[model samples]
Structures are given as C-alpha cells and as structure tokens.
Target: MEFAERHDLLNKTFTPRSPVNQRQLFSGRIDQLAKVQRAVESPGTHAVLYGERGVGKTSLANVAEQIAPIWNSETIALKVTCNSNDTYSTIWRRAFSKITFSEKSQSVGFLSETSINTRSFAETLPQELTSDDVENALQRLKKHARLFIIFDEFDRVFQASSTLTLPFSDTIKSLSDNNYDITVLVVGVADFIGDLIAQHESIERAIVQIPMPRMSSVEIGQIIDTGAARLEMAIENPARQQIVKLSQGLPYITHLIALHSFQEAITNNDANVNKGHVSIGIQTALDEWQASIKTDYVKATTSVQKKNIFREVLLACALAEVDEIGYFAAADVRSPLREVTGQSYDIPNFARHLKEFSSENRGKIIERTGQAKRLRYRFNNPLMRTYVIIRGVAEGMIPLEKIR
Candidate 1:
C-alpha cells in the first residue's frame, strides 16, 4: 500500500475518540448483543445497557440500533443522546424528531393527483408531555412500523433530575401493559441498572438489564487483529500481548495504543508491529491523555511531605484486583502496594491516602463504596485506572514484563 493509503486505512480502522457505529469495526460483547437482539425482537420488552466508563456502552448501543432493523425487517430504529439539561419531555422530543413519517393527499380536480409529504415524528408530540402522551404517540406510530428508540447517555438526564426517570418508568410500564410494538434501550454509565433508571416494580419485568463488562484479553486481541487485518498489517505476538496488558481490559485503551503502534510501524516503514512500536505507543498515549485525567492524577498523587507515598499508593491501587463492578477492598491494595514500594505494607499504612483520594481535596479520583470495615474503592473513572497503570510502566515503577 502507498504511504497515504496506509494512513487512511489507519484512520478508518482505529477510532479511539468515537464509538463504533459500524458492526464490522465493533468487537466482543456477543452475549450483550444477543440480549439486546432478543429484547428488540420481543414486543413490550425494553433494555438497559449499563457499565463503567469506556466499556463501550455507546458503541454497543449504536451497533444494536444499526442491526435491529436486520433482525426484524419492519423495525425502525432511532437514537437521541441526552445532556445535563435534558428532561423527560425533551429527551422524548429529540428521539421522536429522528423519525420521519409520510402523509399522502389527493387532489379534488378532474385530473386527480396524489401528493406525499414527509414530516418528523416530533410534529405529532404535544408541548406538555406526559408518559401517557408518549405512549399514545408510540401506539399510533406502531400501526405503521415497530419502533426501537435508544436513549444514549441516559445517566446525564438521570443525574440532572432523578425524577425525570419516573416518567420513563411510567412510559415503559404503559407500553408493556398495552403490548405496544415499541422498544426502548437506555444506555449509560452505571454499575447497576437502578443507577440509570428509576426502580419500579411495575416495569421490572418489562426491561432487560445488559451489563457490559470490560473486554477480555482474547476479545481485545480481536480488536487488534481485525484492525491490523483491514490494513493488511501484521502485529507480532509480543506486541499484541503488550497492548492487551496495557489496555487493562478496556477497548478504548486498546484502540489508542494500537493506533499509535500502527502509526509507529508505518513511520519506520515496517508492516510488522513489534514491542518497540508498542512502547512508543504507550508513551504517546500517556502524553496525549486528556487534560482532565492528567489533572486528576496530579491532584490524587501530589503531596507536601518529603517522603511522599501518594504516588506509589495510587499506582498500587491501580494494580489492585477489582471485582466485576470494579470495586476493590483495602486488602486488595496491600499486595500490590508491597510490590510497588518494595516494602511490607498494611491497611493502616495507607488508609489516609485512600480516604484522601475519595475526597474532593484530592480530585476524588477514586470513589469509596460500602461502609465501615466492608468498604470498597474504585476509580471514579475507569480510564483513570488504565492511565495510572501506564504511568507506572512509563516511570519504571512497573516493569513492562510484570504487566501480566
């Protein structure tokens, strides 16, 4: 391939900043996709896709919307993203606007002619909206086509007003009770479905909860392989394994590092990507990390004492083992802390550091959950966890060989 062609292929294959809207570019989450397919195929059933940040919830939702019509030829999929200022009525208005409907009219003249007009579904919605209003509009539209409405970033609306979810809950219940042919998919960042939607027993059975976990090593490798194959490039085993370890199970990290690694190989005029390229990729990924994340890391690790342990402690926290939801107990940090610091450590040694990390004074990089002795901690942003680990390797605190 020519130089420009390779660069173009690189751009098209790796998209760290954007969600994968095309099914061909998306990887993993087969089970999540299956659950979504089932929900879309079944009437009066909706789905909620929730997970920690950077787990590709939006990408899954996007691909789901694209493929839903394939699963049912009559299905019409529409999506609307939520913002902090969005309310229940505004959200539905945005969703409905994506749908275009047609109207036919016949002339009364001798040479009678038929005229077709197209308009947005939003035109049918009333100014003062209620769950009944939404249900009624959807019910009317169902006569022509089955609807699949995706409410992406739903957590933003919920965070703006927890009460806003009440109307959505009411709408879901109404639709299910009436056996409407419409499905609603709510996508957002949350450990539990309740974090994104209002808890209502009436709509409990009407919705399917699809929790998206981080990609596994094998799944992450598919992303690397698929992208490399598209460009007709080869990524050696060691380089592929390094990217997976550095990614720490997040797809976003994989893309970021892989994009740079491919670029590095191309610059060196080598079609094969190796560990040296991956090392450069890691450096570039950290250097180009978002300002907010860098700021938070500095805040979480900065200290006044000469013998500061904040940085080491934070790195230990990053290397700590986390459960399915990303929560880890204080005990989990001890082993990693000992490894990072080359010293024996216990809960009391860095208890204050954990408390400070969860406080606003330290940017609240890690969030504290549970209570008393049973408390667990997790990074407020999952990407921050990956960032911390990469920083460790970059600073020699963590050797590349020790990644796995």
Candidate 2:
C-alpha cells in the first residue's frame, strides 16, 4: 500500500469507543435511527433508548442528535452525560446553561441607544426546584426553537437518588402531554425500561421506548466493509467472517478486531487481510483485553470444579447457533460440555453454577430467565463472551475450524 493510502486509512478506519460522525461510516442501526427521527419530528413524542453496555446506545444518541433536525427544521439537539452524582436539579441546571439564547435588549435612561444584555434560563433558575419549574422553563425556551434534550447515562440519576425517578418521570410526561416544543431523549444501559426508571403505568404511553439489541451478522459485515473501503484495503472472506463471528454482536469488538488486523497487514506490507492476520488480530485483542477478562473470570470461578465447569460452559455458549450469540439455553451447552469433558452432568448440576453466575454479589457474569424446563441465559458483558471465544481457541478448547 502507498504511504498516503495507509495514512488515510489508519485515520478513518477505526473508532472503538467514540461515536461515529460521518453518516456513511455508521452502520446497522437504520431502524433505531428512524425511531429517534420519528419521535423527534412528531409532536408530543419523546424517546428512551436502553440497551447493554458497549452496544452503541450512546453512539445512536449522538447520531440521532445530529440527524433528528433533518426531519424537522426547528429541532435543536443538546446532550448531557450523567455521572453517579447527578441529581435532577444539577442535571437540569447544566442542561439549561448549555442553551445559547439570543441576547435580550436593555436600555439606559441617558443612552437609550440600542444596547444588548446576554441572559439564560439558568441564570434565574432556582436551586431548589420542582417538576413544574422545569416544565415552565422548557415551555419558555421552546418558543425560540424546538428542543431535543438527550440525557446520556441517564441511569446515573436514579442510581444516585431513587427518589428522583418519579419526579423525572412526572416531568417527562408533563412535558410531552403539554406539547412543549422540547422532546427529551433518555439513554441508559439496562435490560428493560423498568430497570432504569420507576415502574409507573402512567409512563407506559408517555415515552417511545427503543431497545437497542446487538448487531446482526449482516450489520457487522457492513461495518467491516465500510471501514475497509475507507482504508483502501481488502479483507478476505475468511478474515471478515472470523471477526464478525467472534464479535458476538457488539460493534466495539468488531472495531478492535478489525483495527488489529489492519495494523497487522500494514506491518507485513499487505493490502489483503487473510485468516492468518485475523488469527494474530484475535491474539492481540485478547492480550489487550486480558486484564479485565481475567479479573471477571477469577471472580466467576472460585472453586476448582466450578472453574472447570465454566470453561466448558463458555465454550458451549460460544459454539451456540449463530442466531443465539450472547444467549443460550442449558440444553444448548450440554452437548458441548459432554464433548469437552466426556462427563454427563444433568441440568440440576449445572443449575447451581448458573445460579452462582447470575448472583448479584458473586459472578454477575450472566443473567438467566424462564422456568426450570425452559431456562435461558445471556452474558451480561459481551467482552466476557469475546474473552471466552479467544480463550477457548487459544487453549484448544474450541477448534479454529469452528470459529472460521
């Protein structure tokens, strides 16, 4: 590859954590993006986007903020990220301060000539406030421009103060019902809406809930192709398939794997990434992610027997049907366990391990649902699944052919 080509590709090809800005670079989220646009355009409609960590919830929020205005010319999107210490008053204070209002006119008795004074809602916004105060402030601001306020990491509000949930929920419902020109978009990491906010029946119809799921195989492929195209590089079918399969539906993993593969090929003075480059890329990603995965793995497996059992369980989960990447049933894991361990263990035996893995104070590696006969489970962290896949292959627990 030429120096200019390599430099441009390296600059444009990889972004593991930050949100993608260019529309063509963003991939596989057409539906969610459309929902956000619709909610922004329609009167009295707000949205809440919830999903697992690293599933691109924040990225979608960022992209929506940029494009929502395309559907409505008056829309103005503003976003604020919350921390564990954020409260309703503090968060709203920050939001109001960020709004850039046109300067208000002021006059002096002697010099009645045109004079201007800058002002913002936050200047007079009370420290001790209620939902009504926020609604009133938003109502006044909406006359100038339609608002799209995004509360990224919104779960922090409730985590900091559970009492704020009802107030926040009430404020959202009131703002929506009153037809204020402002639409609030809440983004968080959770399995369900109720987990993030208070379970209020009144909120059921007040907000448009968009649950962001893991990317599909086709979507992951788009990301690979889009990045490779930008870099003026090519990824062989085997290499592309390897990255997507091991990504486990998370876009971050895809970026990490692809970045490593790109760097590996560049080092070798090659433009095409083959399975060999992918294999090395996997090892590199595994090394970079080793510390965190080992910490979680050690926490998940305390006993020798549990450790042995978990190795088999993770390999089985990785080997599950492509459709069932993060989630798999115990029955799905049984066949692989028998293959790996050559020992027949009943569901009852695995049940204890699952319970421990799902416990809050313990492993917290997985979450399970359903009854005894139809139990299902999913990795709480997609990185854990990626770690499992890499470990399985490195340790010879999983065959290379299986992943390819």
Candidate 3:
C-alpha cells in the first residue's frame, strides 16, 4: 500500500482516544447489546449500564442508540452527557432540544395543506421542571412513536447532587406505571448500580442492571483481528498474544498497543507485525501516556532512601489478582511481590506502602475499601493499573516471559 493510504487505513481502523461511534467499528459485548436492545423494545422498561473506567460503557451506549432506529421505524432516540453543572431541569431541556416535532396544518377548501410547523420539545417544557411535568410532557407525544433517551456520564450528576437521582427515579416510575412508550438508559463509571443512581429502589423493578465487566481475552483478540482484517495486515502469534495478555482485558490498552505495533510494521516496510514491533509499540505507548498518569506513578513510587521498596510493592499491586470490581487485598500482592524479588514477603512488609499509596501524600493512586480487618485495595483509576503493569514490563521489574 502507498504511504498515505496506509496512514488513512490506520486512522480509520484504530480509535484509542475516542469511543466506538460506528457499529461496524465496534467489537464484542454481544450479550450487553442484546440486553440493551431488549430494554428499548420492551415498553415501560429501562436500563442502567455501570462499569469501571475504560471498559467501553460509552461505546456500548453509542452503538445502542445508533441501532434503535433499525428495530422500530418510528423510534426517536436522543442522548445527552451530564456534567458537574447539569441539573435535572437543564438535562431534560438539553435532551428535548434535539427532538424536532412536525405538525401539519388542517386542509381547507382552496388552501389544502397550507403549511407545516416544526418545533423542539424543549419549547413545550415549563421553566421549572419536576417528575410530574416531565411525565405529562412525554405523555403528550404520539402514542405510536417510541422514545429512547440515554443519559451518558450519569455519575457526574450523582456526584453533583445525590438527591438529583430521585427526580429521575420518580419520572421513570411514573412512565413505567402508565406503560408509556419511553425507555431511559443510564451509562456511567461505577462499581455498583447504587453508586450511579440514588433512590433506585423505587425504580428497581422498572430497569435492567447491566454491569459491563472488562472484555475477555477472546473478545480483546477479536478487536485486534477485526481491525487488522480491515487493514489487510497480519500479526504474528507471539505479538498477538503479547498484546492480549498485556491489555489486561481493557479495550483501550488493546487499541493503543495495536495501533502503534501496526505503525511500527508500516514504518519498517514489513508485511507482518512481529514481537519486535510490539516492543517498540509498548515503548511508544508509555511515552505517549498522559502526564497525569506518569506523575501519579512517580508520586506513588518515589522515596528518599535508595533501598525503599515502594516501587516493588506498587508493581506487585499492579500484578495482584483483582475481583470483578478490581479490588485486591494485601494478601493478593504477596505472591507477585515474592515472584518479582525472589524473596519471601508478608503483608506486614508492604502494608505501610499500600496505605501510603491510598493517601493524598502519594497521589492516592490506589483506593482502600472495607474495614481495617478485611481491607481491600484497587487503583483509583483503572487505566492507572494498566499503566503500572506496562511500565513494570518495560523497566524489567516484570519479565516479559512471565507476563501471562
């Protein structure tokens, strides 16, 4: 392929910094997509999609919105992202503004179909909004038309005001009770459903709780294979396995590493991407990571003494086994620590380091959960965990041969 053509193909195939907007570019998540489709198709049913960061929650929501029209010709899908400044009234107004309602004039003797009027749903809403007001306005819409409203980044609204979710709960309950043709999908970064929606008990029976875990190795490989097929590129088995294992089940890491590996092969005029290309790709990924992540790593590992174990402990924490929500206990770190240092270790040896990582003094890189007797830890940002592992492998603390 020509130089410019390969560059274009790379750009079209990989999206590390953006969510998957087109259905053709999306991969995996078949079961999650089915649940979302079912929610939209069933009257009086809604959905809440909650998961850890970088797990592709927004991408799923985007694809769900795009496919709604295919399921029903009269489906009107609308979406709005919530920010710290958004209120219940402002959010509804923003969503309603995207809806354009068309009205036809009555036909007369000589002026048949004189004109048509078009207006946004926002114009119909009163200045101050409430659950009853939203329900009444929605009820006025054509009975045959189905409405799908997706509120992305809903955690931002919850962070701004815990009470804000009550209005939404009430609105959903009202709509479900009346069997309206409206479906609401809430997408956010959260470990649990309650973290994103307060007063959810009232609407518990009305919505489906879809928790998006990290992608499986098979699913992550599908992303690489799909993109590589689009570019007519071949990836060696070792390189492919390295990317999948290092990705640690996060799609963002897969895209980042795969994009650079493909670029490395193209620059070398090679027909296939190999292990060497993956090495260069890993280095490039580390170099291009956000400054904030780098800073957080330094803060967590820096020490005044030359023999300090902060760096080793933090790396062990990265390699530690985590549960579905990403929480890992101190005991989980002991095994990885021993493997890295070839020395016997215990919780007491690194417990203080773990505490410091969770403190503001160490940039709070890891968050502590549970009581003192049964404390568990997880990285404050899921992406940070991936960064730690990659950095470890690059720096020789984690041997590449032992990654999997």
Q: Residues 206-278, candidate 2, lDDT per residue (tens digit)?
A: 6888888988999999999998887778999988988888886788888888888888888888889899998
Q: How much lDDT does each candidate structure score? A: 0.88, 0.78, 0.87
Candidate 1: minimum summed lDDT over ten consecutive residues — where? 190-199
Residue ranges of candidate 3 with Cα displaced over 4 Å: 103-118, 142-144, 195-200
Query: Would you list the clashing residue pairs of candidate 3?
Result: none
Cα lDDT, model 1, residue 37: 93
Candidates 1 and 2 compared: the better one by TM-score is 1
Ranking by TM-score: 1, 3, 2
TM-score of every prediction relative to native: 0.95, 0.86, 0.94
Greater-TM-score candidate between 1 and 3: 1
- The runs of at least 3 residues in candidate 1 whose Cα sits more than 4 Å from the true structure, single-residue gaps closed, are 104-116, 195-199
Note the clash tally of each candidate. Answer: 0, 0, 0
By summed lDDT, which 10 consecutive residues of candidate 2 come out lowest?
Answer: 317-326
Better model by lDDT: candidate 1 vs candidate 2: 1
lDDT of residue 238 for candidate 1: 92
Lowest summed-lDDT stretch of 10 residues in model 3?
A: 191-200
